[model samples]
Target: MKRTDIYPMPEFFERYINLTDDVELKDAFAISLQELKQLPLDKWEAIGDKVYAPDKWTIKDILQHMIDTERILTYRALCIARGENARLPAFDEESYARHTDASNRTLEDLIDELSLVRASSLAMFNSFTEEMLQRSGLSFRGSYSVLALGFIVTGHQRWHLNIIKERYEVLG
Candidate 1:
């Protein structure tokens, strides 16, 4: 499904969804993955745990956050597509980051986890039929379609990539 098919877009997810192009959800994932794999890892490694601002997440932390969010979004899509009616619980990203051991992990390790999680997400979304893709479910913010979740996953990745480039990359 195309990004434009997402009707009555949930307010909270607008920023992430808007960052993506109005393309097929599968292609959005591919484009984002290609962009991710093309990042200058050597330069990013030089930045290490440095944060552009105080209390901001380091590169590794950001990578871990990406993996975590993708998994959550993918699971939400799965549950929604299966006709789940329960309002999914919202997660506290800051709390997850605070409890994470991303600080002790290498950038490579975090990136690997993110890549694996994204691959799983890609496979899962690709399995959904057009009708399943249109399935919507209630969340903490509001209702969201399976198609929107797929785009949000990719778009959220791009959002962080932009921050890393504009903010963190300069630190190198």
Candidate 2:
């Protein structure tokens, strides 16, 4: 499936869509996994609780957010692909960051969990048929397709990784 297959693009998601270059869903997923695997975990650990600015997320917080958001997007894709019509609610990232115990966990641990999560996501997405990939559903922001959600998952990670490179000085 291609990004063009996603109908009624959610306005808020345009940035993420633009960040992605791959038009094919499988290629997009593979690129996302490759980029994630190349993250400089050592540099992230070296930074250690450092936030680029006041009231900003720490490196650990960003990593945790990536994992959390990936899981949420994957779930949304699954639901949409299954033809669920429920309108999903929005999540408060700041609130989630504050409440999460990511600070207690090592970067290595988070990365490992992220790998597992991505693997599960791959398995689920790999099972989707073309019709399933084109399925759409209501969300807090707007309508989204299973294919778009898949791309969003990848692009969202790319967006965060760019921030990490620019703000946190973590080499990609």
Candidate 3:
């Protein structure tokens, strides 16, 4: 799915769409990667503790949501990078949200989980060669270049960060 937005979802990642194959999307990924890694526990917890606006999610919920997204999108990216040609299965985000209790878990734990997944994802991406970046494959959304699939990691993260910062944090 191609979604454009006003902030990071669109702007921060705008550089990726024009980038030709063989360039590391990791440089783009690195923009927010470290800062996201270093976000204080207090900040992460604050998102959890604040009461969100009507119909929005708590900071904890947002973090939990991002954690879930990282798992899904990275797997998709990896599958494409690894030469998978079949269509990936779709998952229901709303159903998963109801099954997990973001409220019960500490914000620190959620942050830790994000850190772990991101670390794994970074390692996975770093291991890919320029040839791998040029690989072609299909995902649940249909066919895409391996290079384009790689950009989804940071693009998706930046997408949610925009929501969290502007809506979840501000409105909370």
Candidate 4:
């Protein structure tokens, strides 16, 4: 691991301070990337195809979602790291979801695209210095210091993974 200073945890983080291992954020990111990578294409088709409701997200849709979220956040992180002081743009996730047509796309196509997107984002993430992750980003949606949001990105996918296993997988 690269040696860099971790910004002081935000006051808002008290509720979540112990929820995750701060040391493992990078590791978790790596593991999620690996998990998504190791999932067999056919298995993605079978399990992912059945994961969502008729009009809801399929497994491919979930992958699309993960990639999309990463895309937006990564760009925001870049803008902040570049010394941009502009407010963050508000995003309508439901609108994006509707317009993406992810629901109708084949599971394989979405996964391939998602895999590519993840690779791109991971490369970006690896390059970030701790200071860059702590920079503040402003947006109509709200203010989020890069350091604070980093945890969200790390934990958010795991949150969804559990949902897929418990809710969508129909596990007892």
Between prediction 3 and prediction 4, the one with superior TM-score is 3
Q: Kindly list the per-residue Cα lDDT of model 1 for residues 14-54, writing each as its tens digit.
A: 89999999999989988887877888899998998899999
**TM-score on alpha carbons, each prediction:** 0.96, 0.92, 0.75, 0.74
Q: Which stretches of candidate 2 lie over 4 Å from their true place?
A: 170-172
Best of the two (2, 4) by lDDT: 2
Per-residue lDDT of model 2, residues 1-172, tens digit only: 7777677676888788779885687778777778778878778878888887889988778889989998988989988888898897788889889899999999888878877887788789889999998888888688878888888887887898899889898422
Q: In model 4, which regions exceed 4 Å deviation?
A: 1-21, 40-44, 47-55
- The clash number for model 3 is 2
Once superposed on the true structure, which residue ranges of model 3 sit more than 4 Å away at CA? 1-23, 38-51
Span of ten consecutive residues with least summed lDDT in model 4: 1-10
How many pairs of residues in model 1 come into backbone collision?
Answer: 0
Q: Which window of 10 residues has the lowest lDDT sum in candidate 2?
A: 163-172
How do the residues 73-151 of candidate 4 rate in per-residue lDDT, one tens digit apiece? 7787678877789787867766777677776788667667766766776677667776777677776446666655555
How far is 80's C-alpha from truth in model 3 (Å)? 2.0
Clashing pairs in 4: 87-138, 88-138, 88-139
Superposition error at 17 for model 4 (Å): 9.2
The model with the greater lDDT, 3 or 4, is 3
Collision count for each candidate, in order = 0, 0, 2, 3
